[model samples]
Target: MRTLAERAGVSSATISLALRGHPRISAATRRRILRLAEQLGYRPDPSIAKLMLHLRTRRPPGFQSLLAALTTVPEAEEQPYLRELRRSAQARAEALGYGLTVLRVAADAARRPDLERMLRARGVDGILLLPMAAPREFRPLLDWRKFSVVSATNAVLAPQFHRVVPHQFSNALLLCEELTRRGYRRLGLVMNSRHDLTVGHGPSAAVVWQNMLGGTERVMPLIFDPAGAGDLREWFERERPDAIIAEGADNAQDIARQLGLRVPGPVGFVTTNRSGPSVFAGIEERPDEIGAAAIRLLTSLIQHGEKGIPKVPTVTMVAGAWVEGRSVRAPSRAAPRKAATA
Candidate 1:
């Protein structure tokens, strides 16, 4: 400050105000001081800058008082994994000296009020939006410009905002390779048709891509629709995959039981998205970690006052951790013999 002021023939106070673009400094003097500072390569120390910012804002650091989660509450049987996300997010927010409020809006509701107004009324300047099974209405349902919004789901495809989620594609690819390396020849993917949208189709795509990279063995994915189980057994028999990968371990086990197949005896089971520690071998999506990370990003956004959807939205992907469980087994010498037709 003194060096720049001396170079520009001004007091250090004038140099400071001019560099900060304070209107009190005359335009010409401000420009001259700014030019001198640039020539001197002056950069404010971050600690000093933060201290000055606190003084100017007349508020303590962490000015963001509260944050809210705007969610389209799903039907009772919907994604139960989201429950863990909210719990973990709330815990993380409190740890960071911020408050987290979950505001629910039913997906089937007829009247969708001004969500932003309600949020503002609650004094929330930041948001963590957990989109419903179908986020088609995410745009029309909320005012994007009023808050620093971050999504915890990759399913929020339209009118994009910054998001944090698991590395679904890589997780799937890793699962396939792991199974194959263990001697499973034909690998199968069974999951809800709607779930394809949830992880952004990363698992589905990765499975297909891995299949393409393999030898002759291949199994077409069975996209399960709850309305109709739709030949899950027939698909399993036809594919005769040595291993099965489903959304969760429970789904895989149930499907195997229904098919009268011996799990890990002939056919191994693994889950692509494990909710938590389990007896299933596969990737742990770690919704808790993802939730914590989302809060961290949201706090940074709020601190910077980055309200509104970013022009180039960012996605922070947390890699899924491989959890060894009893569901999978050693490499298969050959796929189980094909089942007989009716």
Candidate 2:
């Protein structure tokens, strides 16, 4: 430490802070100290450092042991995505031999006391944040260097932390290509307005559909509120799309029938997620693979004692399968063009 300080022409404290990658250290000084440490072959003993801090503060045993803190906010009802994420995380943690602790914060817990207290206590070594309707600002309350954290969902708007999300872009492109190969052209997409393009699969699917169709195909964006079934039916009737891609297969079929459209014989449909039933051609989304990947990433950070922005923030995406259901039909062969009359 003293050598690094002298070589970098900075205080020993500055050297220490820089080695820990403290945000308070000036960027120039941090860079110099890091370069010096590398040249001098200096490496801090993480275990000893933790022990010394505990000894000075009289903290509890296992203060440095790894703990994955899973957190979610209270909602009216548990969302299907969140439920699947929770199940996958717990199962992965058990397989990896790590302790998992879940913390539920109230809707307004961002400004509350309990959350701050838990952070100060160092209750966990890292956090896996689940998706929520409302954003939470808990990063400022904790020492990021002491813990590693990553958000399981793309709900983190700022991209302030590491994330593992579905590869919606590529997945959507694949789906579009498959549909084209299966002899369907006029494609339509139905999605909620509030769905995040980066986090959710809907937007990517839309972009891919547009690009794949170019100027030759008709693409419709049907935004419907579940509360207004009448508006939904009206849009379907007016558009009269040949094939529809929706989040809900059953609901889409019902709406299609209400519009006097026949499924599998005339109008066809596909689903983005095969969550409830495999009643239509759909993408699997592979939520379980996403869950397992998040665990692997978090554990890697813990095992290596890595903290703050990973050297390489991994964006792991799993592909969804194309399951054929009774909702898609082979396009009718166009009538042979009659030879021009002589």
Candidate 3:
């Protein structure tokens, strides 16, 4: 410590705090100290660090370390995506020598007090917020200073902390380009307004960006109201899109059939969410991977004693991969022309 402090021209105390990512230390100084430490091949011994933590905390000898999976509802009522998220989080936490606990925040006014009391009593070291379909802000009632926290959902809008989520924009771009390569010229994206907003408008914007790149007439997105009677035939006749990208390829195929259009014969379809059967060519947003990444980030924050809302929150995005299905196939333009002539 003395050697590093002398080389970095900082007091030994400052060097110690900077190495531990203490919030009181300036970020610039921290970086400089870390760079110097790396250059000098200086590393902290884990055994000593653990011993120091034990001495400081004076935790019960048999107490098991724990991490919390914070959610809005119980696991049984959670959506399939959220269930996968929780499952993966639990697996990762267990592997890291910590038990995972699911705590659902009640919707009532007494939520904050009860939740905070339980967390405090359990001595949770970190928290992982599960993803939600609708955007939300973490309740301000709970004291955030107690534990390191991370959200796995982009739906969180306030008290910005570090988050892990799907790379929606890049995933949409990849899907669009792949569809174009399959000879889909007039491609259209179908999404409800709420779904568009929930994903931060990534899918809608991706389609528009792709249209600009090709200098082609932009096939305006089909934004339908979920509650209203969405007339797919009317939109198809007006837009004349060669392919449609939506949440469900099966439903898109059904809509085409109802309009006397053959799937993959005249119009191709792609799905964004592949929760059930792989009947559509689309992107698979891997919720499991997102959950694992969130746990990893949360553990790092806990290790470095990072807590509360970060001044500059960082987002880590996991890119989804394309799943090929029978709903979309290579376009046969020549065959179509021949059939038209015949």
Candidate 4:
């Protein structure tokens, strides 16, 4: 500060105000001071900058405020996975000296009265969106310019808010390689198209790409409607794959039984998420970690007063951990018997 002020022929106080772009400093003086600082390579330390910001925004005790986890999904408490995300987010918010609340806003306008008003009334300035099973556009009547917001799902297509999610692409590729290492070939991927699109088709695309890289006969992915479970068995029978990768636990179990196959005995099975205790080897999405990261990002945005859709939206991916379960095994190496002489 002293050196720059001397070079710019100004007092240290004038240099500080000019560099900070305080309104009291004339524009010409601000430009001059900035140019001098640049020439001197006088960059402010980030720690000092953050301390100065904290001093400026310091609130008296008891003024510490609330943030919100906004959701459109009903009966969120009944869903243990959603509960885990909320719990993790709340814990992180508390750790950052802010209280967090979960607010369920109905999708229907009749039931969802002015969400913006509700938020402003409670003085909530930051919002964390929970993951949804299906993609939905956020057509809020509220003024989005007033608050910092982020989503934990790709389901929010409108406004393209920043997101934090599982690394579906790499995770799927890793799973396929792991399955191959276990001596399982003829891998089949089955998932609902809607759900696949909701996650940006990374998992499904990875499966196909991996199969293509193997330089063998291409196996088609079996995409089925999740609401229609009856066809699952039919697809399994038709594909006759040595192993299957799916997202639903019940559907996988049912298809395995219909084929008269025991998991890891005759055929192998893998699930995409560890939503519950199961005998299937799968990936753990770790919603808790994702939730914590969302809070961390949201807090930074709130502190910076960044609101509305970001010009450069970012998607932060958390890699899922693989869980080894009793659902896969090494492929049979028995030689094919010679065809009977005809």
Candidate 5:
């Protein structure tokens, strides 16, 4: 401690304070101390850390520990949900007295071995994964057995980690009900075949079940892929849906334009995954709340020393809220309702 303090030109007491993430120490000093600690190959002893943690239990918790959030840079066609998830996780972790380190996926993949060693050395015992499209893209980057892991969404397919994702079934039901209440009976669902699987086919189930009810029309979900939506026009003609619920606003708009239809006019359109604000009425799946919930679950796992995949993995799903826009007609006389809860 004294040596690291001397190297950083700070007192031993300051070094200890910085190591524990004491608020009294300036942020600049804490960063420099941690950087120096890393550069000098200073690995904290787990036994001492546990002992200190035990000692501090009676008092208000100080800096509890450090966690790392693995995230990716968004692509041109991608939504900002993953980034927002990581940001929310970071904020919640800090508020709970746990420091968070943000690590990029593409940038860190090449030197993963060194990264692994560094994380273990720095006592980063928890990982909050925020992969954008597919978690498979991140599987090869690290050995997961060493740390307590939590994901921001169900996007993790390969070896499913404990995750907090939006409750797609609940969101779909909410969307279907809201659309129906707005005087739309013939409703059709459109989703890429690949996306539907990733989300566990929640929307498809909702569409099928809703159409079976008293006041709705039967419209089978059109599941397409990147190869092409070759039969989209054919499907639309056959279904003649009054309103369409789609995965992407842009994709739906493209198809709608080809069909010579006006959105929110003779035909209404809604999206299941609406990112940010737009001229579309749909469900805004709250990734921020998902991230925060993941952090909360992860901290519990870490405190209990539960590392690696559990015997029976559990999922925590957050409910999404409805966002209104000009893409759909106004609701009938009955008042607007709050977001769904499940």
Candidate 6:
């Protein structure tokens, strides 16, 4: 910085302000300072800036403030699951005497320079990424050593990074096993193929279903496509599965009716995520618990000045609960009869 300022014929403070693009510095002087800094190979130290910020800001005692960044494309609104997870995390943070700030990274901010600048300027101590539909391609862009980070879902697979997510594979296996125990042999899976491809969670569930079937032809895969309901109908008719495990109960019920199958009798259903008001049998991935755990981990890292990937990072898995509903029926129940006489 000294050499750059001398070469630019400006005071050291002027050079610092210009290099940082402070509004007080004239644009022409800023350009000159940047060019001189480049000639001298000057790089601003982030640690120094962090120390300065700490000295300037007088934080209240026992207060641990952190930034929870949600890296998504611009215009991404809060979905139901994300809203619930954020609420749980925020509530937990408050209980622990910490302040939580949510940040959304725009698509253009994925670039390295922009991301680093934003994080450093904000002085974020930690970050918690919400579940993303696809793995973000910005892992290598930022300096991970500056802040602690935790992904809310297994959708992002960064080795040696702490992750908190539900045990999806085990949940699927347990769901299938329970259905088999209840004498539902011919079971089928209905899911959105696009969602599966984006997150790789669907394939894990499929593997569990296949194992539960014991190499038999009792397992069927019925992928849903909004533009191709006719194809789905044909597949359902030909498969004729006695029971269906679907992600959404209402959609599954409607499809079952379209195939001339009576619910809880000729065809049974189970919801993968019981999101709506009605209760249904399925796995409840305890997202709220996962969110709270992530915040706790982040706090630990911040308190210890631990950053980047831990040398021995750990993964925490919260098992899903089996919720029983009226959609499923035991095989011993009598078959459905025609409409009763008036």
TM-score of each: 0.77, 0.66, 0.74, 0.77, 0.75, 0.67
Instruction: Show model 3 residue runs off by greater than 4 Å.
Output: 1-64, 73-79, 106-111, 225-231, 248-265, 331-342
**178-247 in candidate 3: lDDT tens per residue?**
7776778888887877667667788888888877675445797888776786777788789888888886
Task: Give one digit per residue, the lDDT tens place, for model 1 in 119-193.
Answer: 778888788977465545466666668788899986666668999988888888778777876777788888887
Q: How many residue pairs clash in each candidate?
A: 3, 0, 0, 0, 0, 0
Tell me the tens digit of each residue's lDDT in model 2 across 1-342: 888888877788887767665445655666677777898999888998898666745733222334554445554566665678777887777665556766665544344445545764755656776765554455544455656777776655543677776666655554555566566666667766545333455444554455455332765567655445536666666766566776656656776776676666676777766564566877777777777778778866654456775666666666666666788864245522222110
Cα lDDT computed for each candidate against the true fold? 0.76, 0.63, 0.76, 0.76, 0.79, 0.65
**Would you give me the overall lDDT of model 1?**
0.76
Candidate 1 vs. truth: CA RMSD? Answer: 7.9
- Stretches off by above 4 angstroms in model 2 are 1-76, 79-81, 107-109, 119-122, 134-146, 196-216, 224-230, 250-265, 308-314, 330-342
For model 6, name the residue pairs that clash.
none
Off by over 4 Å in 1: 1-42, 46-63, 74-80, 108-111, 330-342
Q: Candidate 5, residues 1-342: lDDT per residue as tens digits?
A: 889988998788898878876546765777788899999999888999899778876575568788998755544534667667778898889777798997766633444888899899998979987755542445667788888899875556645788888889899989888897788998899887777876878888888888987369888778887667558888988988898888867866886788888875778899888887677888888988988899989987775556787778888888888889898989887745545545
Candidate 1, which ten residues in sequence have the lowest lDDT sum? 333-342
Estimate, for each residue in 1-342, the C-alpha lDDT of model 4 and write its tens digit.
999878888899998777665545655777778887888899898998899778865753233567988776787333655778888998888876788988776654233346777888898978888876467777553566777888898877776888998898877876776677677777888888778887889889888987788532356888776676546666666767888888757757876777777876767899877667888888888889999999989977775457788999999998887777889874345522222110
Sorted by lDDT (best first), the order is: 5, 1, 4, 3, 6, 2
Which predicted model would earn the best lDDT? 5
Clash count, candidate 4: 0
In model 6, where do residues sit more than 4 Å from their true spots? 1-61, 71-77, 107-109, 157-160, 197-217, 223-230, 249-265, 310-313, 330-342
Ranking by TM-score: 1, 4, 5, 3, 6, 2
Q: How does model 6 score by TM-score?
A: 0.67
Weakest ten-residue segment in model 4 by summed lDDT? 333-342
How does model 1 score by TM-score?
Answer: 0.77
lDDT of 4: 0.76
